[model samples]
Target: MLHFLPAPLRGLIGATLLALNTLACCVPLFSVTLLKICLPFPAAQRLCRWLMDFIHEAWISCNKVWMNLLGNTQWQVEGLQGLDYQHSYLVTSNHQSWVDILVLQYLLNRRVRPLKFFLKQELIWVPVIGLCWWALGFPFMKRYSKAYLAKHPEKKGKDLQTTRRTCAKFSQTSVGIFNFLEGTRHTPAKHAAQQSPFKHLLKPKAGGIAFVLDAMGEQLHSIVNVTIHYPQGNPGFWDILSGNVDEVVVRFKELPIPAEFIGRNYDQDEAYRLQFQQWVNQLWLEKDAELSELKQRFPGH
Candidate 1:
């Protein structure tokens, strides 16, 4: 096994495996695109679904290979079975490192239609990856600043309209909408600057989740509240591959879709919006407590 190799040698092997993983994923991706464009309706859909399955399988295989070869980072996922592919879901997770994305892809893939993320409208032009994301049905949002909204008051609800239109197009399939409610990666400095009420997370941005709920709440079955912990430390991507990380613990808790949350106007109804914000605030509080306990157990770098 590569685990017994010298540390430097192990890192080389890890890098090699990562390269192979990327190369391996491309073949199926290209094949799916070709089939999607050339094939008929149900046939194309079937082929695309198969490609998604292949990608998810490759992801697992690559993660397993990298972890075993490097032997420093380990992953533990709880409540993975809580995800239901048959129903729509809004998955919220606390952001920490780029590793969070990989961890998400590892856990949520196949079970959840490839985990569509909300992106800024500009990300639609990031070359091949951007095109792939669009093809896979990720939502691109145009966020307006408060200052701009005040100047052009009529434009206030336009973003929500855009979101609703985009999400409405997928009539038949259930999708997993993933958002990091903290809005950015968590850091001690960001936490302090934001003066967050929660001890562990930065301030939660309710607008994103509220918009999704407003646009697609009827189809949404549950909210997947996920908490991720880095026991060794929050490491960068290279740190993970170089056998520097200790372990990652991820927890998922599925909460039912509240009746009041459905069909609410998140932009216009202050009372409904406040009620939703409070609901998210309570989840962050529980996550804060969990993070505290986890920090005590894991400590940090």
Candidate 2:
């Protein structure tokens, strides 16, 4: 480990290494994406996705190398058994910090199907990396605010419709679709501002995961419920680069989606919507307790 180096220097080295890795991987990613579009055959498209996944994993593997060389952050993870790379999973987790994304990708890269996150529609236009995300089949979501929806009543359920369309394409292939249940990162200020009930989490948003299940519930093998706790406390992306992160605890459980939930219309059915909200609330309640326990049990080494 390069722990002896000054942290700012390590951070600069880490950033440069990761940027180079991403640029290296994006070239082949775009090439295969173009090949897939030109061919237009199912067989050819499948081949392109496979090739892209290989490239995607390689990029992540390179990041792992840089992470190992930069610092000595300990990873404590469990409940990864029985996961199949060939099966689709709805992976849900609590939001803490930007570091959560790195921890998830670092630990769960090849253990499950490649994770495709739901991105904001505007992100598609970002630049080189935006196209790389598109090439990897990340679903870009355009969300409408309540005020906008109220002004244009005709646009109701549009987000759900878009999700349904995107998920339909995923049905043909195995993927790990990830969503952060807490829409935003949790912080003491945010918790107090929102008057959140849970001690260690923000309010769990039901609409996001409900929409995912409504669209592709039957195709998904199970819900990969994940909890990530940083015993050193939540840290930003810079903390990772600066070698400040000491330890991370991750726990996962595979929960079966109820048969009745398959193909349910969340927007149209009021009763189902209430039931789903209750279910999500219960999950957040448990996760909050888990975080409380991890804090007590897993102090930093």
Candidate 3:
């Protein structure tokens, strides 16, 4: 183990290895992606997807090696039972740090289908990683502000159209669709600015997930509600890379999607929209309480 190395050296080595891993995997991944694109047949697309998923999993496994070599962080995880890889899930989490991505990637890799986050439409242009995301079938959303929507009256109801059109691509495969309910990482400054109701979380944005359910409600098997905690305080990506993070805790619960939510239009139906937001609020309440319990369990958080 290189855990004995200095933090700077560990971080440097980790970053280098991660870059190399991504570059190496992207080579084959891009090739398969090209093949998938050039040939639009269902069988060809399926083959390419399988190849890409394997490459992605390999990339994640390489990260595991480097992390194990660098840090001895303790892990406390629960509620990971009865997960099926063949099933699709709408995964939601409390966002805190960039490391949360790696944690989830590490924790649920093969336990469920590989995760594909709902990304912004602009992210599809983000160099090599962007292409990879596109190849992997991550849905890109074109979100419009209320004012913008009002200015362009024609754009109204198009959000649902975009969501449904993008989500239609997922119907053929079982992939984990992830959304950070808070929409951004939580921070003390942000908490104070927003006057957050929860001590630890920012306000949960209900619209994104609501749109997701409205589109893929039939395809998704269930909602996988995940709560991640950093007992040593939320670490920056660099902190994790440098082996400064001492311990991590994460909880996973498979929540059944409410039957009423299925086949419901979140934007068109006012009643469904209100009821869905309430459901999300209650879920957030439980997640906040769990964070509190975890904080107490670890002490000095």
Candidate 4:
């Protein structure tokens, strides 16, 4: 890609493309905000759904346009079969790069409603993207630190309750809740800092999933557990655009929501919590092993 264009020119062009895409994304966001203010609650909800679909469509278009402009990189997706668009799913995956978001979006766009991520409260302040996420019905959450909780005992379960209420009110017209079990993108330094127990990812964060399961357990029909492998290793956005990235293998396994797990106490019940943690850790172990094998086979990818 741009093997003909000098490195400086290629970088400049990529920057221009990013700017253009950002500008284009703002149109739908502004439109949705205005519609929400003007319409009735029920009408506004329908409009929001349409707006999210439109935004995702535009995002896919942007990805295709940019990749084509830089080079003709082939994109591959698989394992989408019998995915009911009318059912609610909890999507869990390993986090590696920002690119992970796009890969998931591209694969599951029409397959399900665009994913509603559980975001940190402060992300609400991020420029355009923040506002769009809010308008699209993503729940912004605030986690209390242990020290803060100790100081203000009254505030102990407040955040979790707030999250539960917010998420419980979320529209149930078929959607995916995406969670990065590792909590953050994977990097050698960060992984070392955490002294992770697994080879491929940081330790699983149970609190986040626990909150989600507690809040939306009755509505959740299945778990869309995805395993993503970037054959060589994780790649930056530029690596993807420059055709330096090789294969991205994705495996999808749907797990049924257990009857016993529904609406169970995640915090007070130590035994149940331990059992849930063990199940999540087993998933990470299998993912780590799969990624290791893929890396070995595509050593230079």
Candidate 5:
């Protein structure tokens, strides 16, 4: 049992197994991607997608096996009733540590569609994994800052145009899109520096989710709001692998995407932007309170 092993040995073993699992899955994924690229037919694309999904689900299954074998963490989860894997979803959560991604993958793996993240366009060049992500249909977003857009003038609406095209691709299949509304992981220093309005979260940015809703239109079924808490403290990935983190709490709440938000231009419409921001802020407020209660109930977790 990993409990009897030294912390260093536990971490080393867990890391090694995870690396091996990733490599095993990625090799076949790369091959399928090449095949999809070369064939460029609708049927071939669908076949490649099905194969990639199988490989990815197997990878997640392997990760779960390693977690149960190597980690001593207790999972407390709630609000997952009546989820349909075939439906499309827009999932948002509070970002605490890098380990949150693993937690989401573990909990939501077949309850909904496979989780796909919005990656920066530049990440597509990050070597082997980059092509794997592209092959798996992760949308690469090219965002132009306001200052840069001001200088270019002609490229102002380019980002949203790209988002619309990406959404069109996603409409062909059921998929779950993940957006970390805070845009970055949380830290005490960041919390203080931003003068954050919430007790436990950084300010939620409205633009990303707004664009997603507008781009996806009615194709997206519902919003899955997730709150992840580590009552012992936010643990790094190594802490989880080393059997140091004892408990993780995850809660899921599903809400309908308000009809008014669909097809509304977040960049051009002032009223819609304010209303969407207010809605997101309210969600953050509730999450902050829920986190406080979770920590209180599981003292010394």
Candidate 6:
């Protein structure tokens, strides 16, 4: 029914429904988050987290419903076999558009533990959703650039210290840590600017995931490599909402974290850093080839 409507009308309706769903969830989510913040006791905090997870899962379910109702995208997802929700996972994927987050949530909802993203520290101030992210245990990272660190030499290892402290909390529960290895969305102009070695991807940044491994390496059960391909071209959020995107392919592959890579110094140890970079680059090469095959199989929208 939405497909027959004008694009603007479909977009309005879809956007309205999504906004309503978000508003509905955010109210209760914020309320519980406030309660969690005030309650300092461990048991009380655990209870609040459990309640927040229930609300968050419901929100994801509602968004999935909205996706089904408004979008006509064909989804081809694989490699979800043998996943256990009780185990912690480090999930890495290529970033294309904002819709990737929704797609991941739709696919990984109950298949694994709840997804927790490594958000920029500044995002914690973005109104209600920021608080929600905080209550849900997303690690907020304050990354310093090389130039900035050069100026303030004393603040050098502060970010890693923060990561270590935040990750320690995840040891109490099963969680899925998501990292976008490309660090930004892919665009033709941006890809050309980087002179990326991979035909379909930007250069993979190893530092963020490397920091995560250093912090939570012993606790993480496996690394989940997810490859997402937009067969109809990578669409914007509005395009997806308005039913413009036709197909999306998501493939998942779980690999073990090498023992040598765990608990290693990613910044100070040059040899370990080189080895880790090689491993991530190899994964990117494989993903780039996989994207090529997918494009060949699904040539056009």
lDDT of 1: 0.78
lDDT value, candidate 3, whole model? 0.88
List where candidate 6 sits over 4 angstroms from the true fold.
none
Q: Please provide TM-scores, in order, for all candidate models, with all chains considered together.
A: 0.86, 0.97, 0.96, 0.88, 0.95, 0.95
lDDT of all predictions: 0.78, 0.88, 0.88, 0.76, 0.88, 0.87
Total clashes in model 3, counting residue pairs 3 or more apart in sequence or in different chains: 0
Candidate 6 per-residue lDDT, tens place, 1-301, comes to: 4677788888898788878887898888888878887898989888887888788889889888877777687889899997898899999999999999988999999888779888889999997678778867788888789899999999897877877887888878778889999988999998999999899999999988898899999999999999999877888999877877788899999999999999999979999999999999999999999999988987774
How many clashing pairs per prediction, in order?
Answer: 0, 0, 0, 0, 0, 0
> Per-residue alpha-carbon lDDT of model 5 for 1-301, expressed as tens digits?
4777898998998888888998888889989989988999999988988898889889899988888887777899998997899999999999999899989999999898789888889999986668778888888888878899889999987767877777788878888989999988999999999999899999998888899899886888899999998988899989877777789989999998988889999999999999999999999999999999988887673
TM-score of 1: 0.86
- Give residue 214's error in model 1 in angstroms: 1.7
Residue 71, candidate 1: how far off, in angstroms?
3.1
All candidates: CA RMSD (Å)? 2.8, 1.2, 1.4, 2.5, 1.5, 1.5
Q: What C-alpha lDDT, on a 0 to 100 scale, does residue 230 get in candidate 1? A: 89
At residue 106, candidate 6 shows an lDDT of: 93
lDDT of 2 by residue, 210-245 (tens): 999988898899999999999877898998877778
For candidate 1, the 10 contiguous residues with the lowest summed lDDT are 52-61
With a 3 Å backbone cut-off (N, CA, C), the pairs that clash in candidate 5 are: none
- How does candidate 3 fare on TM-score? 0.96
Which digits, one per residue and each the tens of the lDDT, describe model 3 over residues 184-271?
A: 8899999999999998899999988888888889888999999998988889898777777788899999999998988788878999
